[model samples]
Target: MTTVADAVGWDGALDALAERIAPRFCRPEARRRAGQYLAGLLAPVERKNGWQLAEVAGDANPDGVQDFLARMRWDAEAVRDDLRGYVVEHLGDSQAVLVLDETGFVKKGTRSVGVQRQYSGTAGRIENCQIGVFLGYAGRLGHALIDRALYLPQAWAGDEERRRAAWVPEAVAFATKPKLGLAMLERALDAGVPCAWVAADSVYGADSVLRQALVRRRIGYVLAVTSGQRLFPGTVSDWVEDVPADGWHRLSAGDGSKGPRLYDWAHLPFRGAPEEWGKGLLIRRRLADGDLTFYFNFAPAGTALKELVRVAGTRWTIESGFELAKGEVGLDQYEVRSWTGWHRHITLAMLALAFLTVVRTAAIGGKGPGRLGRRTSALDRAGDPSPAPPAARPSDPKTRHRYCLVALAKTSPAAGAALSLETPHPNR
Candidate 1:
């Protein structure tokens, strides 16, 4: 059974997290506004828009919340740095994979920054929306989105008036999603995020510049590509479809909602003496429909197929993380229309999700509190002394929602801790 002490401890953990990032805000009022906004986001609210969030935060005027998002002087990037430090501290692993993907935020008006009729995987069709390129860190500890970039279409990029109205910086220029993904990857590496592999869908993998950047960094990756993408076994003309049926080996990328995601896999090494990092074409054929997919893999020579397949499997974690953030934490429910406001809201939402991830990890006996730089793995927590008893398990969406609300509602001295920062919540 849950106890008051347990609730206090949970609240304390969240408060401690907020304290860690509170200094990022320029003023105490900004910090308080940030804390309240985050609490409202994590709370069980049907709509997490400005008005709804402001009401839940006990503010009579929603314009205050809107102003906080629009005119606040807080450093969103500093909060992001804190987030990266927190994630690396708790979830860092030598074998961790950094996954890249983009999600569409549907918006109706043309005035919303970067909104255009475009293809959204979220909707599975062309829709009017803005895209946010995201980078996720997936390790044995757990997965969470650590970085994000707003995708500005070329039309908006060329339109100085629209850019100025949206508060986009003058130095900001048009960059493709893959370039954005690469920039995030570079930032993660520079921040000392311990990762061995990277994974992404074809949209990124198709970019040779991105693949080359990964090779230069000596980071391994299993990135999907179109069948038409050229492969070089003996010659550059070779394509993924050239692989013979006899070469295909049945394998499972990883577990899916239904069961093992089994497929027929094959690989062919690129021609010429292999560099310190090897190059190859990895293919997957569906077991039932016989549909084929391809990946351009870069790893050390003699790397096993299973390792590449495992890295490929890690790609889905970002998707799962997206679903969880959007559904449970209102990642896509924002009413903000400007670039800075969007970043502020999304960054806060990510901070909240990180807190939840930490809570979930602690509940499962994963790790205890400590400074951000010290290395701690799920396997290394056995020797660490416990700080407080674990909070209740947040395995259920409704249960998780209840925990957030209850922890926020019942104010204890410990609960006085303030600001930290979805995907749709998905069934386990």
Candidate 2:
């Protein structure tokens, strides 16, 4: 079998990424282990646990690989800084959105850090899992996770023994998912990761504090809210369900697999006095079932409905990032049991996914790295040769990456097996 070293050297993109992240580690051995870990992640290993990764890296002792993740002195945040820089360099856009969402990693035991019975969107039910809140940067070129935080339940946070066993920092405290999302947003903004809007699902959107925090930063957002969310149109609070039938308008948020994700949309102007900023309620009524979803939007005055809809649509980009990262880079396939180890593995996996996204974009002839503008449709980037219309490929970026990976494997037999892991077991 072709070795992992040969596979790493076979791809210029992988090599460049390795060099990019090498400086984060002070010790040469640390750097070497980091490279080996990344190579194993990018390798199409069936199970990306420490032992499998160590075996692939040609290490006699798997404990060394575990040590790299568990005890390495490198700063994972510095690597995150590098990741944000790299992503902005390639996919940054003024109109790009910084998206927030959380994914669940199912675990077997209570010993694993932050593991508890929780609602996992990945499993579509309550499961024993650890939750990870992630922020993704999405632009015309593509999207990739820029930062992440592991969510600790209140039980885990209050138990000192459990916390110590997990190596939770002394300063770390119990924080809700939205708070974690806000902290990540602040970090991205502090690093000057350019983005025009912030988007998230109702979990974060329903938090009035999170919304106010965004307003304080002068950052615009289109965040989903529950139907019961109250809004004021003229000093009178009104439930989103109170809107009249005539208030709704047919609009397409963005294109999807079948066609446009058409829905009945309506906007209610806020009652507040005219100011530099604007607040409003944007509602989407499903065409098929009339199931309504509400969004709380904050933007500059005169912002068009299409733009608000566009921002709301961008929420899926983070979901796409999650799916691809888990499927291709083993985002949740770690054996680590501590807080630091989880961050180490996740950050490295994110780096691998970012590299693959960049490669996939370049391979599919995506637009040159440039300024962000109006949203770019996926059809514009797909360099499909078949006579079928671009819509045939669906606007999903993950599909594009899969196709590119398959093509790359065909051209390079040495890296084929390592690049062709089975398709992600359907979401759960």
Candidate 3:
């Protein structure tokens, strides 16, 4: 059995990445500690807080590690710039998708920077948490978080005393989540990080400024919007109801854990764009319940429906990337409170994740994973052991073929078992 460490030069890869960003740190001690800090994040430490990280780094106390985060002289943005270059060098794609989203970090007490009562998707409800807007790159090679901004709520941004205590810079001001996302997107574009499409949920889609900016850039997008949002003439839900049966196409919006994310997809094109640009409302219906979802799409004329579906599907890559980073690289395990501390820790963790992404990409022969380090297989298409027909099977060829494969597996257990053994289950 080949372990991940054996397949990728794990230590050497980390060392090379550490060396690549070494110039970001001023003092030799800060440079050395930064490397150690990154290693600690990549290590199998349970909590990944400062104390635990220090113990893993063989330091007597947490002072050195804590100082490295709080009082370090290095600029987090400089290291972030290097991180972007590293990702683009290894995973760049001209048709790549730049995904913008936010994740919440649950925190206690009143003093933690940006911590307040808010709705956290991580918690599934309203709670005291901090939100961080992040930009991710999904390409032919793989996906990883490339840039991040800690979202400061209106309360914290206005409270002068809290801002002083938390070391929030004077230039920092209240910016909505969409604004933060737009800033990060602009940074990625200015750096020439290759991408053809942008994907986001309704939070950013509702921002006309962001959408118009993408339009001016000549970049394409598949941005989700609320069903109630107006689409020039009527609500999006109204438009969805007007689509006839023949307009719908059953397609696989890329593969998921179970198999292809089979959905009923259709779009209503908008007129008045230049000859080169196409605009429309893309709709997706659930096969199980016929529930509807909507997206605002902007692409070059003659772009295939399947191509838009592919761009829409790429949105999941950032979600899976977040899970991998939090699960495998301790992306949200930091215990920092100050503005500087948060950025420093997050940047180091992202670097660790980028290293893993590059190594896994190489191991998988540059055939990108459905999620980072994990690829979908024929076994995924082999549904249940008993091969019962789904309640609502679409007439699409891909959907029909999936059922056939399931039936074949049931009829030939030996062949199915052989196929299962030939393809390794992904390591969590």
Candidate 4:
């Protein structure tokens, strides 16, 4: 049946959802105002109360607005569990790959969470920015966002001066980006949602501590290492089969593509501390339109080459999520200046991704070729881990899926609305 929301444009669907989820159940008036404000902007424009922004959210009445939302903390755990069920149930037998990526929001000044002179994906260079760690869901059925976290740079944890300058909350402290990524993965596992493989870029991949941590947890992974990354080089000449080829050979991909062209690796069984054991190695390739590269990993035996490719390919999917959220969906365009406001904007982006994923798979049934999603072409790649006993197989149970854009049913022209026949279509 046609609903009032279907009659409007983009604003309709988001407005309907906001009402249903957080709705001004407690502060209807404030939330109502907040809803209207967000519906108007599509860029990083300032929101004003009067002739400024068409609609403004937050407390109209300082006391009621602040009191209502202030008392509210984002239900991150609840949000994760809900998204997990909705996403996994659609999996069927299809393998779900978790793509880990970090995108930075360029901040003009300090004070934003995790803001530092770091590499900003959005800006494509090093700058002062806020970094968000994310997990993207990919299978034949759909491509969607799964979880997120704001990386609190070490400055926030170690230096009191920077912390004070950046307004780092007394409760907020420094945590590594990988640590945050691990926390997000654990949340999904606790909720009983499992991924077939985890993939990342060199930043997280090259971290020895992080790699060992994943090995201990027994999570299957693939990561890119710098050309200079250290590894035991196995024997070059073939030797006796049962001789226990303990001899090591450490080689380099040496400026292969970005760093080196060839790889130097060893297949030593997982060794070192418990968290660093229970793993082996695999070198997989992603043959996309862009230049394909080899990945160096410490994976167990019996892992499939194709499955590793799929998981590694998943990293490209997160790039799509970031592009759509930032450009088409208004991720960084929010006008709210507070820290809470920044997170709320990102949460909305996540919700939008989840909502779109569910709709495309369940209602629209994603199917087609050469849709909106672009293939990946990253200069570097990475992966993740969990400390545990070695698993019997490389990846878990298998499934198949192919994805495309959601088939949105077109709505007839809105009733009682005027159309400007002479106005040229802006898209033209």
lDDT of each: 0.76, 0.75, 0.78, 0.49
Report RMSD (Å) for each prediction in the order shown.
15.9, 16.6, 16.2, 18.6
TM-score of each: 0.83, 0.80, 0.84, 0.60
Tens digit per residue, CA lDDT, model 2, 1-428: 33454334347456666666666676789889888888898888797887789898998868999888887677787778777877887777988999999999999989999999999998999999999999999888889999999999999999888887777876789999999999999999987888889999989998989988888888999998776664433211244444544445566667787887877666654534236766767778788997878888888766766678788888888888898888888899999898888998999999888877876675456433222112221222233221221111122321101111101112221111222111222222
Best by TM-score: 3
lDDT of 1 by residue, 176-269 (tens): 9999999999999997799999999999999999998888889999999876765433322245445544445666778899997888666665
lDDT tens readout by residue for model 3, 1-428: 33665544556667767877776777899889998998898888787887889998999899999898888677788779888888987799999999998888998898889999999877789999999889999999889999999999999998888887788887788999999999999999998999999999999988999999999899999999999987656678887655544556677788898988988777666655556886778889999999998999888876767788889988998889888888887888888898888998999888889888887777677433222332221123233132222122122322101100000011121111211101111221
For candidate 3, give the lDDT of residue 85. Answer: 81
Question: Which residue pairs clash within candidate 2?
Answer: 44-418
Off by over 4 Å in 4: 1-20, 23-77, 89-94, 158-167, 234-281, 284-294, 298-301, 362-428
The window of 10 residues in a row where model 3 has the poorest summed lDDT is 400-409
Greater TM-score among 2 and 4 belongs to: 2
Which of candidates 1 and 4 reaches a greater lDDT? 1
Model 2 has a clash total of 1
For candidate 3, report its TM-score.
Answer: 0.84
Shift of residue 385 alpha carbon in model 1, Å: 33
TM-score of 4: 0.60
- Each model's backbone clash number: 14, 1, 0, 37
